[model samples]
Target: MTYIVAYIASLIVFGALDAIWLTTMTSRIYRPVLGDILLSDLRIAPALAFYLLYPVGLVVFAAMPALRSGSAGTALAHGALFGLIAYATYDLTNYATLRSWTLQITLIDLAYGTAVAGLTALAAYQAARWVAG
Candidate 1:
């Protein structure tokens, strides 16, 4: 039950936050920089796969461990590191291979990803605590 709560909370918080960021930034950030490479429409399957899978990673790697340790700081720290590494893996790869990818985009994504993941982990930790009690 506690782990379930943590997983759901992580999913909801991260999903909601990232949805807002993607919708808001698609025009202002992504399109401006990646317009040439941008598809006319988003591919739903890949997006759904990523959205669904990422929270599981967060749950196992960050939230679950923190929940076990009973430490919110652990959740946040691990989650942030996870986010940094995950986002960097994607953004840096793009920056390296794609002609249009930029430092600004990579840096911005790193910041947002780290912040959101940490916040999601904290939220998940709190939710798990509430459920366990």
Candidate 2:
């Protein structure tokens, strides 16, 4: 039950933040930086999949452990680490394989991912604790 709560909370928090991030960064950062490579439209399936599933990773890797430890700090730390690793992998892979990928994009994405994921996990952990209490 706590785990379920954590998952849903993370989903809501991460989704909301990521939505804002995407909308804000699309034109100001991503589009300008990756001009010609920008897609005409987002592919719904993969986008939906990412939005839906990313929180599960947050819940499992960050929130759950924090809940067990009863420490919100744990949530933030674990989440940030997870986010960094995950984002680093994605960005580094793209930079390596795709000519269009750039250091600016990779750095921006890493920062965003680290901050957002940490915030999401901390929020979810707090939500779960609040509910449980």
Candidate 3:
């Protein structure tokens, strides 16, 4: 039950933050470089899958451990590392395989991912603590 609460909290926090970032930040950053490669219409299925699935990774890797430790710092550090690795897996792979992918985009995304994951995990950890209390 606590795990479920933490998961939901993390998902909500991550989803909200990600939506804001995508709306306000990513387009300006990505569109100039990605141009036509940036789709005019977002494919809903993959986007939905990402939102649903990525939080599961966070819950397992960062939130659970942090909850066990009762330490927000643990959550932030582990979450950041997980984010870096996960985002790198995507951005680096695209940089390597895709003709249009840019090093700039990869680097920016890696940073963004790390920050977002760390903060989201921190939020989740704190929310769980509050809920538990």
lDDT per residue, candidate 2, 10-97, as tens digits?
8889888988998888899878768888788999999889878888898999998998899999999999998999899999999999
lDDT score, candidate 2, position 78: 95
**Can you write out model 3's per-residue Cα lDDT over 1-133, one digit (the tens) per residue?**
7678778887899999999989987668888887887888899999999988888888789988998998889999989998999999999999999888989889989999999999888877877778888
For residues 12-67, what per-residue lDDT tens digits would candidate 1 score against the true structure?
Answer: 99989998998899899889989879999889999989988888878888988998
Report every candidate's CA lDDT.
0.90, 0.91, 0.88
Which residue pairs in candidate 2 collide? none
Per-model TM-score on C-alpha atoms: 0.96, 0.95, 0.94
Q: Please rank every candidate by lDDT, starting with the best.
A: 2, 1, 3
RMSD of each: 0.9, 1.0, 1.1
Considering lDDT, which of the candidate structures 1 and 3 is the better prediction for this target? 1
Candidate 1: which stretches are off by over 4 Å? Answer: none
Q: Candidate 1 at 17: error in angstroms?
A: 0.2
Poorly placed runs, candidate 3 (over 4 Å) = none
